[model samples]
Target chain A: MNSTSAPEPAQPTERIPAAERREQILAAASRVFGERGYSGATTDQVARVAGISQPYVVRMFGTKENLFLEVLARALDRLVTSFRQIIQEPREAGPAATELLASRLGAAYVDLIEDRGILLSLMQAFISGHNPVIGAKARAGFLEIYRMLRDEAGFPPDTIREFLADGMLFNTLLAIRLPDIFHEDPAAAELMRCTFRGKLDVVLDATAAESTDADAAPAPPAAGHVDAAKDDK
Target chain B: MNSTSAPEPAQPTERIPAAERREQILAAASRVFGERGYSGATTDQVARVAGISQPYVVRMFGTKENLFLEVLARALDRLVTSFRQIIQEPREAGPAATELLASRLGAAYVDLIEDRGILLSLMQAFISGHNPVIGAKARAGFLEIYRMLRDEAGFPPDTIREFLADGMLFNTLLAIRLPDIFHEDPAAAELMRCTFRGKLDVVLDATAAESTDADAAPAPPAAGHVDAAKDDK
Candidate 1:
């Protein structure tokens, strides 16, 4: 668990800009909330992960719910942005445009789950739907993704639905870490082999590779891509 | 939320036999733990739901974890039992046996999800996989279902995997109550329409129908069915 937490600072005296600090805190909060979930996570833990004071953590976010709202929003935004970029990219002229788009979009989702925190945090939000604010956000976020796939990506309704269904299966598979648990069981192994088809090794390898470079620089956005403005609602 | 909790007893003083009382408590615990999850659920609430004292609840299960394990075990058992019953039934001759078996087993799964608590509790167990005991139970339970599908039902690896994948998507859709959320939005509604492929109404209607008869008599087991002894592991 400690290993999964953010690394301790080398020198505590270094001061960062407020905007930079906010991003840092949000990143740490994502990991904490992702791991422990919204109800189980604490600002104290988020602060510790961010290498900041607990009071500052609360002061920055105003409340725990507020902090979680920001985390949920950010995770959703990243997903929406990832999908939008894939849709906007130029594609070859062929009868297979829909399949190609679906494949690329699926790959993008697989990449997003590699972050671990992003997908889990979104799932936590969905599960915590008894809270009206969280429930509204989850529903709206889900709808936004659906709309992007259908309207923006121009995929048929059935195609989009199948894509989302496959995505949900992948989410559950990753959430349970089925690969790790079923590696020794033949039937389980065969099930996973069919579930992921040929992409299992690619996803597993990518996730493994990402974990080793825990403190590596963030990848730059693709050229000509613009981050979508946060949906205030 | 209170409405979702077990209804309060009209007369709380009826003394039931210990075995019967244990089953009552387990049923109530399933609902509470399903709705609130393991961390969020409290034994006091389970006691209230069961119309028994908290002390009695604790005495029966020893701990919350134990109670949850029992609930998890029961839910998994019911699911396995449902699938096994479907597989054991005589089917039409020819290559269509596999398709017939898959369809019947799928319907059995859809029926189990109508219990609400059963699927949610099992999902919560999977998400709480960091706990060694819970993790082991969840893995073994999941594998048991997979093995039952493969060995007992004789589904080929790919067919079983796809069936399970579709099941996961259904679980996610049900967990979020997508039909209720998307009813007001056209595009969202279309996506769900394609996702469920005309079966959405059936699932929603069945779930609604089940909630009304919360304390109805349990359905009798099929003839020739033998209850598999609980796996102590």
Candidate 2:
């Protein structure tokens, strides 16, 4: 429903390929949508962030809603692929078998701070009601993640529900930028200490690095990548 | 910073009291912020929903951000007051003592569908990170809820974490309006049936009733109430 035919041309030094341009836009969309939110973000901002023309963004994705759908799909793909890879990996068997798997999955989710948008963008999607196409796609993808945990991960429904809930909680901490303030607020510190534990330093460091880079430039998008490193549980 | 002096005046036939009028705006803000989110809502829209003049809205709550802070405080107040009341209520304890408390708390949360905005508005607050005044206030309130469960309810850290996570998940389901679609999607239905357990029909009915009323009129603002029914765990 973007009726903006007015053009704001991409001031690219040279012509970028359409496919590459689309990837750039998606990457930019993730950050913009994640930071600003789906309802709040506009293609013009995404285009500006991507260093592309506004019309070009509309041409490729058609609408902000559609672009957010792609970001959601991408985030879900990252979760599926990452979890599958973790499942396939060799692990030491222990008395607490599921705990090991859960820890790895938890670490993978924390590691997603490398691409913070994956978590935050999904936050935007979760709150969008189910009647809309985004709502349907998001809930279905969320369930797909749920089913993966249930069927493949061999976790019970309650366990899977807890895992998903924990993931959403972690997502909340990040979205609220709690990592930045854990040192300041005692309650936040206690919670972060408990939530992150050993990874607290790592998350803090990742957030620091990301913020520093964000101040200087937009995050290098996870364009055209399907690696475990991009896995945002 | 809403600087729009171009006023769209309220059409109230008679004068409404200042205290009552303030409550009306807060109630309207809850739904508006819950639905549109903090970043997405404007004072103009909040004023419209509250049936007050835009300039009057600006006069009462200096900015949209300030208005949201009040809404967040109100939601947290409702949570605290409700939970305290539940704790005070006499219970028929048996072999499963805490389960009774937990169930009562869960029912209280479900009962919050009466003012769905409290849950959804808090959802908006939870995901807001810790630097902005909103982020700081929201997280602190959230942790207050956490500590209450730990000290008063006497649940362990992991259990508390799980409880908060589950609450967040429930908020996600509501935010995405998953209850509305449970009948249509099998995965959704299975999850709803499991999550809602004995309260599925109640949640579904409440949602249906809320949606119908929402279509017909704004669900009544929970202005200055501290009843057990408002306890959104």
Candidate 3:
């Protein structure tokens, strides 16, 4: 089953236009993988979707695995770009950093779930190990976002950080897939947002309170050692 | 593709005991469906796993579709029984209702994820539309759980009740699947628990606040003739 030979480089007569063909192939690969999953899908199906021959597809992508990995990578890039764009959008310019971050992140989540439900499907497919080659990359993309939100998003650092990470990702899935599950009952989404905001507020308030308490208490030289141990060991 | 029906359930064979045969068949069915998913899995494979003839498999379960539904339903019933047992467990004699609910729910969740990882695969198989026969039942089962939690969990009637419902279901899925993504990190599971608790606290607090607000507000008079305007047309 392994066809290991690398196809010869395209000559002038056989050369396809770069940008359009690449996008077309990627779109075909994405839809096919999304429908049939990686293991069940075939190159012929992808080629049929792209309106190209299987040989041409192999020439461009080398193997089905390579093509799937590229599609997953592109999906991740799309998520990162969408997130960054949402974050940079103007939200209550004068609010404190944490509140501003929360509102912005929440709004971004709503937009992504509502508009790009397919991305969530794609992410689920990748993470569920339906396709081994893309699964690793998809997981890396997820962990990358989790880390960025934990380290970069201006939330008060505490136990709540992990909670926010998991809850955010989890609720996003529900919001995208089962919109009807919440549609007939608007309270469903509202309750989720309220809980999310309220818990975040608690963490923020408590962290701020602790900061003042730290100022009043004598600085212990051993506190830094404990934190370093927590990080390192 | 339909095979001729076996002769009205052949008289019990003495080679195997009745209950043991049933257990062996069910266990094999689970493994077959779990591996190939509902649509792709075949009766022959199930028969192979059960170490019985294909005709015996058919006689035992009627059809492949019927067999798939049986396995799915059996899994769900087992899950319900497990959860009910946890909820009924004695909890320190007199813990607060809300805290007791949380601890029991959390323990059930941990047990569900750890002891039943195949459930995640089963859920994904159905949700991803890889198995339409099982998918319909799975979706129905989930919707039923959502209703029970939202309506019967004893939260006072309010918008936050819906939020609690959504979050509770969402947290359960994360508890099962997030560990797979963060497999090497010991903190992943702990983080999931903290996040669930914080969010649950938000729902509880919000419900309490809403009840207080309702108590302070004057009752609105019943609208006896609101239909008068529509009747005029």
Taking the tens digit of each residue's C-alpha lDDT, what string does model 3 give over B80-133? 676566656665545377556654654554354333223433454444343344
DockQ (0 to 1) for model 3? 0.07
lDDT of candidate 3 over A1-233, digit per residue (tens) = 12222222232223459677887778767655654555556676666556555677778888877887787777667666776776666666554766667656655554443322235435444334423445456555655655556655644434235334444444432422333333454544444344444443333232233211111212222234554566433
Instruction: Give the 10-residue window scoring lowest on summed lDDT in candidate 3 chain B.
Output: B211-220
* Pairs that collide, model 1: none
Could you tell which candidate, 2 or 3, scores higher by TM-score?
2
Which candidate's DockQ is highest? Answer: 2
What lDDT would each prediction earn against the true structure? 0.71, 0.74, 0.49
Cα error of candidate 3 at position A91, Å: 6.6
User: Of the candidates numbered 1 and 2, which has the greater TM-score value?
Assistant: 1
Q: Stretches of candidate 2 above 4 Å error? A: A1-15, A51-56, A88-100, A212-233, B1-14, B42-48, B51-56, B88-103, B151-154, B212-233
Q: Tell me the lDDT of model 1 at B30.
A: 79
Query: Lowest-lDDT window of 10 residues in candidate 2 chain A?
Result: A211-220
**Stretches > 4 Å off in candidate 1:** A1-13, A205-233, B1-10, B197-199, B206-233
Query: lDDT winner among the candidates?
Result: 2
TM-score order of candidates, top first: 1, 2, 3
